[model samples]
Target: MAITDAGVMYGLLAVGAGLATGLAGIGAGVGEQGIGAAVVGVVAEEPGFLGKGLFLMLLPETLIIFGLAVSLILMFAWTPFAAFMQ
Candidate 1:
């Protein structure tokens, strides 16, 4: 059997995964930050509206949580290429 250098292939895949996670996190952070700032402004104007503002600000955070879950899943799951290389 010939020894194939699978390191490059796995490295590319890992890089892709890192990029996906980074982009996802950046997007989520921006979204959550905007919402949080808006909520703070709204609450400052009308303290009674704090509850609604808080809920809205928190909603965008779910995307980040989902992205994290996806990252975890990818880390644990077996890739076909990894198996082939083995």
Candidate 2:
């Protein structure tokens, strides 16, 4: 079928949402990798520091959560604006 304006807009929005989620996930993964390495090193030096190391490593995970929220908003909360645009 031929693509209409509204269809194109919807596709663009979907792509944008996907990008946001994907990028955030990538960033979180990269960040966690570094932090995880550091945490391991720190823990290796002092076993009692495990809890603090774990906390620091987990902090990067918020990027994924924020990305999920943005994706959800784009998928559902933005529907009204999409309809209005069309």
Candidate 3:
């Protein structure tokens, strides 16, 4: 069997979305690592920093959000949803 051009295009898009999400997740993990360490240290020094520490830790989630958006766009670019949104 032979793969069609449409299949090849979709395959590439899938790869792109996968890469975006995977890399973003990895970046988020790396970001959280430093923030986590700092938050732990800060909390150890002053428990009052709990709210601030948690807030900072959550900031890394933005990376994952962006990745998810890219993934969604890639996955839906050819779908009817695109037309519906316009």
- The runs of at least 3 residues in candidate 1 whose Cα sits more than 4 Å from the true structure, single-residue gaps closed, are 1-4, 81-86
Candidate 3 global TM-score: 0.80
Of candidate 2, the 10-residue stretch with the lowest lDDT total is: 77-86
Tens digit of per-residue lDDT, candidate 1, span 25-86: 88878888988988899889899989998888778677777666666555556475548456
lDDT of each: 0.73, 0.86, 0.86
**Whole-structure CA lDDT of model 1:** 0.73
lDDT of 2 by residue, 8-67 (tens): 767777898898899999999999999999989999999999999999999999989899
| Model 3 Cα shift for residue 53 (angstroms) | 0.2
Regions of model 2 farther than 4 Å from truth: 1-4, 79-86
TM-score of each: 0.68, 0.80, 0.80
TM-score of 1: 0.68
- Higher-scoring candidate on lDDT, 1 or 3: 3
